[model samples]
Target chain A: MKKKRALALLLTTVMGLGLLTGCGGSGSSSESADSKDAEEGKTLSMMCIGTTADAYMEGYQSIIDSFNENNEFGVTVDAEFVSNSDYKTKLTTLMASDSEPDIIFTWELGYLQTFVDGGKIVDLTPYLEEDTAWKDSFNDGMLDQLTYDGKVYGIPTQECVGTMYYNKAIFEENGVAVPTTYEEYRQVCDTLVANGVTPVALASTPDDAWLVSQYIQQLANGIGGYEYFESLKDGTGKWNDDTMVQAAKLFQEEVEAGYYEDGFTGVSGTEAEALFQSGQTAMYYNGSWETSNLDNSEYCEVSEDVSCFTMPAVDAENAYISMGSVDSSYAVSTNCKNVDAAVGLLKYWTNAENASMLLYDYGRMPSTKVELDQSKLSSLCIDVIARFEEQKSLTPWFDRVDTNIGNEFNNCGVSISNGEDPQGIYDGLQEYAQSQS
Target chain B: MKSVFGNKKSIAVFVLPAFIVYAIFCLFPIGYNIYMSFFDTNLMEKSTFVGLNNYIQLAKDATFIKSLKNNILMVIGSLIAHMPLAMFFANAIFKKIKGAAFFQTVFFLPSVICGVAVGLTWTFIYNGNYGLLNAFLGAIGLENLQQVWLSNKNLALFCIIIVVMWQFVGYHMIIQLAAMRNIDSSYYEAASIDGATGWQQFVNITLPMIKPILKIDAVLIITGSLKYFDLIAVMTGGGPNHATEVMSTYMYYQGFNILKYGYSSAIGVVLLLLCAGSVVLSNKVFKTDDTQM
Candidate 1:
């Protein structure tokens, strides 16, 4: 009896150990999750818009290292770049779940409105008011886009405008001169087509429909102004108005004219960009954010020969306004346990030294109004920034301004590209916008 | 009392762990998902009690209706590939042809590969720029027939379905082959002595003998395709404007992308009901008497 009892006790102990080990598995996953929060002795996590594959991450990391070595707050900053397309989804998910990183890169207007409404973002008005130097550090009217209900929600990191980046080498080789007027732009494309080179590389894939729509929106803004879109959003103006219809018809004309590549209706943004970078296409209409891509020697063959010009106005009288906005500005999340540290990092990042480091290394335009020494700036970047500053007025990008109907509007662009009637596309978008309200 | 799982109680105790595990991990989530279908929820926010608004909304949603039609077509495709075609292959192998084992392995190899890998390989094979399909068509002087296989909205779902069929026809063939091997050799021997043709032996004997196993296979295939997720998720993500949205992918999109958790739960409920109904329908179609065996 004693031996049997002893054997039973031994088996029970073994079983107990097995159960204990099985229960321990859950503890390890939780530990790794918490380690993300605990690892920051002085490190602040700044979520930005770029993927690991993007060349811009290496440039951003150097700035982070510089900040770690020298900062008033004695905190090291690290940037985690979520891809541009996935960034908004990740931010909304993280914000709703109360797991947002310390500082978030955000778009302006209604794109950031949801976070403000949900009380998930910190009001930066008091911070701006206290630091007059930092407040004055931004260019005129830059802060207005980031403010909501008379309170600031984010800091504009870089002012961006969409422009037609042309291949100077290709144009010079083909003996085609750059266009100065809207009519001249069309004539240049006509000449390029006669010479057998694709004039513009436009991607019409569903994911990149925004690229085409942005060009249209820019054309519309050049024809009208911000008020036209605002009126449309507020139900005062219709998308099927004469101005929009004209823009759509012009896009279709360009498509039929063989100005874009043969199979561009299904081509993706990267593919179009690749064609442009390979110098097969003379022009690529994209944002200033793509400046880094154009400058990267590994990706762009004509890096040195690429230059930018504002997309010409449909009406010569209107100041040439292109789709411009604050590119991926920074905001502090309400869920951040250490807001002061996050704000400090944001301030450090936008300051002259780190901003210039980012500019020189990554070709990023500075958000702060500090003057860049011409000697240090790339000639192409300098020229682009000069044009960006010269604009009398900057209309915020169409998609960011109208978050609720933006993606649907982009989809309409795709449908139109794929041979759907423009009127039908606009009608569908109009109905969707109505449903949202 | 002795007949009440006597001498097998320890075995039962050993199996208790697995039984409890299966019940907790599998059954509970399905039950909870059904319960969630009645409410309107966003997962992170407060869920409202909306008796059947989600269901009502689902019925009216055009995207959901289109997805339902696509899923029905997918079911027919799966049934044709796994049932009749697989049976044909199984029957051919059962006749002890030369290199039957080699062909069996060749057929079963695709089923063993991960779905995501198969999807990626096929995506390349269907690519427009330098794909094998385009090259083959071009070589045959049929260039006009070539297409961007996975991009066109009308062709994307069919492309995915063909890949699905190619990937799993072998698995079902193996299942039917197992059932075929179980049939007594005496039956075929007796049929041969009676001057019955080979087709007659197969139609009269092999099929009826494998009816019960085929019922199980039908249930497996139907449920498997009903809740399919990974291949479509990796290949297209139901895009070129939700053209390939299946019930599972749609449920994921609503839950994750749009944050419509309550609506997603409603989709989950419908998927469960469809799967359950297919099982019952298959059993009725393949009705069998245990005493016949």
Candidate 2:
């Protein structure tokens, strides 16, 4: 009887401890370790976007390593790298829990606005004003996207515009040239299909729905120009506008006509890119950040033959309008123990030497004004830079405009790809937008 | 020892630790979740109290309705697959069929592999262009039927349901088989002696003997299907325009993707209630007296 009572006590205690430890696993351990480290000195923690598959990861790593070795503050920075696809979910969860890193890789505009509104991100306008030289180093209007209500919350690292990357060898083999008009683009796709070639490598999976939506938005830009996008952003536009429906219909036609590879809707972004890199498809449309992947011999089988052109306009008058915005940006989280160290690290990352290294080595276009050294750039990078210079106005992705409406728009894009009517989809989106307001 | 055991203080001491842990980890979080469901919150900002507004909006939300329907379909699909089909396999093995041991291991293999791995494997099999399914169809001169399985919104859910069914049939079979084995051998021997054939013996001996275990297994299948998440998340991600969205995945999307924590918590509440309701309904339907078991 005594043994039975003792056994019951032991079992209860063990189960209780198991539950407590499981529940507290993410808390007590990290808190004790972090406090211990802080007592010694400052250790700035950062979370940035980089994955093994990204060609620029090496450049990103080298920059971080150099900063860790040479920073004058004697502060050692610990950084965690999350892949781009999972970064948003990870960051939001961390922010909600008040466990976000000191510095975070963030998208500009609406993506950062939520955190700014929540008071989870530190306002960097005062810091910028104090360092006039550092503030002026950035290009004109680059900081505007990261600014909300006259307060800057992030530092821009790179700039990107969408470009149509094509395999020159495939084009030569198929006897097709870069189309300058929407009609000519359709002709080229038709010709490619007639010759048994997949015209575009596109991904329409849920995670990569943004990629599909960007293409449709690009098409809409051709039909309605920069003003259409601006109107949509400012809430004066209806998603069910004629130009938007037309673009969706046109995209649907392409999908049905086999302009994209079969089973493209199920393909992931990386897989779609690989299809183009392996020379299975004639062309691929994505952001200029893909310049590195297309130019890197290790990633692309036909790297030498890969070249880019601005996507042809649906209306020739709106030729230079494009989809693009500030690319990589880093913001200081309000939870940081040392805000100055985090800012110092951002400055170090955006310095001219590092920016140039990233530009020349990884094909990342710096947001700062750096003198172009054409001789060192890959041909694909040079073409992308030229295309960037030609854009009349660059509209950022819809998701970066407003996460709520933009996410719905992405889902609508997938539905459009799956043969749903554009009119009903857009009507629902308009209703959702109105309801939110 | 008896005095110690009999003491109320000792009893409280023995029970307090576990009770405290459960209250903190499980009970408190549930209470907090219910509280948060009435507010519009991102959890980072000051949450605004909306008082049943989230639940009201959920009622009119098409995506939520679609997801709820999908979850119901999943429950029905799992019930059909895990019960009758698993019983057939279990009875076959229990009767000492040829290579029963080998067949059991083979059938049980998929359930042990991780859900993510199972999802990924099935994705490859369903891929349209170079997938095994399409290739097999082509070889058999049925190329017209080779559609993109997961990309087709109408068919995506059924494909996922088939995979779920395939993955867990053996798990339920093993449970039922164990219950069948627990029956006295003399019952089957007596049935055979009474001029009962193999089928007769099975219906008389195995069927009634596994009733209690079957009831438990039914509850497991129903609740497990209602909360199914990882497979859908890893495979379709509730896409082809939300055709494959289940309750759990939609809850995730609302909570994390769009930062509508209040709305998501409402969905979570609905899910919890439905699961509890199902357990109660199943208990009543499968009610067997303790003496009978």
Candidate 3:
């Protein structure tokens, strides 16, 4: 009996120690092994926002492949792509648990600020100061958006702007010109409706509420210009301000006039894009990131006829103001095994070779300056880039600005499109926004 | 043998392994959750102890209140379908009517399939543009009645509830059917000899015998519906302005999407309390002096 008790006690102690070590940080036992692996560099992990279905996923992968082929760090790169809808939540949870990938795809402004404030992201300003050539590769304001408290934390890889993509064949058939003013835009929609064509292809499901909200925000940009957006960003603007209410009212009027696809409230984002791509609708409004989808001949039947223009200003004095921002930024996590190796990968990702490849093949506009190859560029891609250049001001998505208020703003768009009273919705949103702060 | 079985020390030795596993996996997490609910933490920084602030905020939150109401409606919907409707089907099968075995398999089929698959199948069926439901309505010349099935705020939850009703009614039927088969045949023979009708026999002999099982089944249906997550999560995602936001989905949204771990913990605690309250209420409703129960 004494021998049995001793065996049992010993077994339990071993089991308890096993459990304790398993729950503890993995760094302790692996410390020596980690240093040895670091000498050979390591297998670096990168998380990007795109599924296999996205056209740009190919472009992102080729960049990784090329970097692996000729990298100074002896590290091999492995990539993980997450679907757009789930990426934000997945990244945050990973950051909080201290298990995020070495490098992560991020949005600009307040989206990346959450992790910076939590100290899960590396401050890359000193590194940028060391590599001025690489720092200067990005556009002027692109790096500024990812900077916080005078420190840079992420690198912008591309630029995107919301543009109105129209099917030229449908417009020509309807005998309508590209609208340069809000009234002319309304007239264009009326003309398409009279010709028995759905005027605008739009989606309003909660999953794709941001698409609708962006369209509404674009209208507000046209109405109130860059000053209004600055006011909101600086905490001086209200959710129920006249400019916002007016924009929503115009959207509601368009709905009543049947200037949008019928039964559009139920349509999803991809489904709405398909309507324009297949020529079922005259126009689609979305970000420049969709140029690849529009440029594909196999998927888009109206590929040849697709060209874009900025949505005409509601108030002509505010012309050229648009909804856009630095897009597809990358940041090095504090959990990274080697910040230099990760930064090297980021530099490779945004280099002229990869940038031109991404732009020419997949239509992802480079954040840095590069000579245009007209022969390789799609007409739609060129048009979108030109329009992006002409913008007087670019207001990023509200959700990218602040997750809470931006989400509520998206909900407001869904409610408005569903025929809810805009004034009441915005009023409620303002109350919610206040409560959140 | 008697010495080992009767001794408290030996009993503890036998039960210790299982108890330890249960404590680590279940009890510890539940305790941690309840503790976390008292703080205001996003799980990255040092959490601030806010005392009952999360619970108080949940009470005042319109979205949370909407989710609570949605959960209650789901429970009610499940009870209506899983209790009487399921019982009625079980009776038909118990009567040994023609094709009873075939009908049993058909009714039990959906519950065997996974919830996510069921949700996706129903979403395709409910698709606004090219869905079967819309196409069928159009075929029957009821074009005027055709509308978006899952996107309409007023109708989306009802549509999902109807799918839920369709999917689980059969599983509950099988449970009741098993209890029915356990009943002795002699009671019914005596009832027939006494000139009792079929309905009379069912109401007295069959029902009284199965009352205990029915009580347990009611608790199963109620708790299951209250904690339902997969179907709603895969379907609307508590959307069209959170028209179908049940407590489970709302809790997931708060915890994962919004990064409010404390608030979601409070939601979890509320869900637990609701489940416990329903179990007690059900026991009271089914109270009996019969020793067999």
Off by over 4 Å in 2: A1-35, A38-41, B1-12, B197-205
lDDT (0 to 1) per candidate? 0.77, 0.87, 0.86
Error of 2 at A343 (Å): 0.9
Please name the candidate that would achieve the greatest TM-score relative to the true structure. Answer: 2
Q: How many residue pairs clash in all the candidates, one count each?
A: 0, 0, 0
Question: Candidate 2, residue A305: CA error in Å?
Answer: 1.9
True-structure Cα RMSD, model 2: 3.8
DockQ, in order, for the candidates? 0.16, 0.43, 0.25
Q: iRMSD per model?
A: 10.1, 5.7, 10.1
Model 3: residues with Cα > 4 Å off, grouped in runs: A1-41, B1-4, B7-10
Candidate 2 lDDT, A1-437, residue by residue in tens? 45335534644554454345333311211335566555444787788888887889898889888888988877888888898778888887777777778899999989899999999999999889999898999988999999999999999999999999999999999999999888999999999999999999999988899989999999999999999999999999999999999999999999888999987887889999999999999999999999878889898899999998899889999998999999899999888877888889889888899999999988998999888888988888888899999999999999998998899899888888888999998998888888888
lDDT of 3 at B264: 87
Instruction: Give the per-residue lDDT of model 2 (tens digit) for B3-55.
Output: 99999999999999979877877777768778889999998889999999999
lDDT of 3 by residue, A1-437 (tens): 45335534644554464344322211111223344554455877789988655788988998899888888887877789998888987776676566777799999888888778878899999989999998888878889999999999999999999999999999999999999999999999999999899999999887888988998999999888898988887778888888999999999999999988878888988889898889999999999988988888876889999999999999999988888899999999887878888999998888898899999988898999888889988898889888987998889999999876787799779888988888888898888877877
Q: Kindly give the stretch of ten consecutive residues in candidate 1 chain A with the minimal lDDT sum.
A: A22-31
Global lDDT for candidate 3? 0.86
**Weakest ten-residue segment in model 2 chain B by summed lDDT:** B208-217
